[model samples]
Target chain A: MNKGLLIVLSGPSGVGKGTVCSVLRSKMPNLTYSVSATTRPPRQGEVDGVNYFFKTREQFQEMIARDALLEHAEYVDNYYGTPRDFVDRTLASGKDIILEIEVQGALKVKEKFPQGVFIFLMPPSLDELKQRITGRGTEEQHVIDHRMSVAAEEISLIRYYDYAVVNDEIDAACKRIESIIIAEHCRKDRFMSELADMLPASEKV
Target chain B: MNKGLLIVLSGPSGVGKGTVCSVLRSKMPNLTYSVSATTRPPRQGEVDGVNYFFKTREQFQEMIARDALLEHAEYVDNYYGTPRDFVDRTLASGKDIILEIEVQGALKVKEKFPQGVFIFLMPPSLDELKQRITGRGTEEQHVIDHRMSVAAEEISLIRYYDYAVVNDEIDAACKRIESIIIAEHCRKDRFMSELADMLPASEKV
Candidate 1:
């Protein structure tokens, strides 16, 4: 089996990326979601390796020193990062992995794993995104307005991504992501070795 | 409408490219097949621009001199080439065009239109390819042997293609090609304009 693709998916908060990923996981059983390493203590019912690899602050610092983290950031006094070893192991086993990150984190991963497929999930429109955010009924108008501005900044980074998948409908978005992964496998660079094996020894024409 | 993709599909003879394309055309009604202009007179029932754009030798040479042909070659004393204007017009109309050509011709098109998606169709195996060629009952053993050697040479050029689609099954091959085209549409370069338009104007956070 060929090595799995490292896919980095990023979008604004209200773009429905989480829902699309959940649907995609259901559709693609072989897909592995990369569990992050974090300094924060896990909540109840969260399993190690399944949810996040629980790491102490000291251990997380050591991982950074060793270049073991693909990309990491400190959020609310807690360290959160993707473990390079785990991602390499999972990909070497021929299972595709998806990393859901914010725009800055996604760009960081791009620097380390340039071959990884970077996808930007977009909402159908700004109006739709506003509605989705408003439908949550948890944030104040000021917060919603701040989010819209941040989303615009993130959308501007779409040029850095290899693909832009609009999360207009859950099923369609999942299907398109699946198709992108499948099509990526057909790339000539990935299949070169197999093609070489199929070629016969030189013979007179 | 989104701009159309220029797709160049090439494979060795007897790889069932024609059959796959026929099935693909039936499945994808929006796809346009590029008809070539040739100095050779059309056979009975062949209509201009439908079967082939029949052109006099002088007319064909004039087109070449005017740089109106995307790619051209002299074969068996007849000049055959793809018209640049036709392809540009079809793509401008937002209809994807498929150019089914030999490996050499496909590579020529690539030089002119680097943006075109190049796909190399392959058989399941060399043995299968030979079997298919012999099944036609139109060539001697020597000719079949020569064709097989040439196929090997052609397969070596797969590195130049964006994707290598194995035609083990026609339906599967068509689906894979369709997926590639769809995925190509999501490419950041193609969606940049739409994304910029989607970005909201300055608003207070």
Candidate 2:
């Protein structure tokens, strides 16, 4: 079996990353969505290992210190991290692993695993994004403005990603993500070891 | 409209490239198969510009002299080449173009158009390839052996390609090629220009 790929997807809050990922996970069978470990208390009906691997703040720090986490970030006094073991196991089992992380965490993973495919999702337009954020009717006008500002900053980092999919339409975005995954598997470097086994005896010399 | 992609595909003979290309062309409506210009005399029922852009030896040599060809090669006292104009026109019209050439010519195009996507198709195994070559029943046993020997040399150059698709199954191979085309379009460099245009006016300053 071929080894699985590690894909890191990052985008700003209102870019529709979740919608695209949800569709892609349904379409692709061998994908494993990495469940993050968090120190935040579960609100309700959240199960450990399913919703998150709930850990104490001290335990999370210990894991970080021991390098057990692939990547971790502190947000609003809560510790959230990707445990390394599950990711490694999934890859070893020939299942593609997806890490839906922020830009900072995604950059760290890119540094650690240079071969990992990094994808940044973008909204079609700033006005459209503002409309979507405001259309949610959950955030204040000022909060929406702040989100838009942060999105602008994130868009500038698009050059650092391997691919960028614009969420103009959910189906189109999902198809693009699926295509990127398929193409990455066809990469020459990924097939070299398999090809070596198929080389003719004379050519093996 | 966004400009189309120039994809250069090359592999050894009997690697099922034709089958893959045929399937991919059927699946992708915007794809244009590049017709080559050749000095070889047209066979019965062959149509100029459809089968090949039939050219005189003098005209072919003139094209080489003027650098009108993207890539060209001499074989059996006849030259085969890809004209740059038609390809450029097709791309300008926002249609993807495919060049089905040999490894030598493919690499030459790479040198000229560094941005063109290069893919190498390979057979499942050497024995499988030899079987496919012999199974055709058109070539003599000695000719089949010669072809197999040449295939070895071509396989050695597979590392130079950006992607490789194993021709174990035709449908899967076609999907892989199609995915590569879609994924290449999502590459960061391609999206950065569009992203820059979409940035908010305030941020642009």
Q: Which one is best on TM-score?
A: 2
DockQ of 2: 0.63
Off by over 4 Å in 2: A200-205, B200-205
Task: Score candidate 2 by lDDT.
Answer: 0.88
TM-score of chain A of each: 0.95, 0.93
Which stretches in model 1 have alpha-carbon errors above 4 Å?
A: A200-205, B40-45, B200-205
- DockQ of all models, two decimals each: 0.44, 0.63
lDDT of 2 by residue, B63-155 (tens): 999988999988999999999988999999999999988888898998888889999988888899999999888999889989988999888
Q: Lowest summed lDDT over 10 consecutive residues: which window, candidate 2 chain B?
A: B196-205
Q: How far is candidate 2 from the true structure (C-alpha RMSD, Å)?
A: 2.0
Candidate 1's residue-wise lDDT over A1-205, tens digit each?
A: 6899999989988898778888888898889998999999989999998899999999999999999999999999999999999889989998899999989999999999999999999999999999999999999999999988888888888878999998888898887888888889889889877776688656211
* Predicted candidate 1 versus true structure: per-residue lDDT over B18-76, tens digit per residue: 89889999998899999999999989899999988999999999999999998999999
- Supply candidate 1's per-residue lDDT for A170: 88
Alpha-carbon deviation at A161 in model 1, angstroms: 1.5
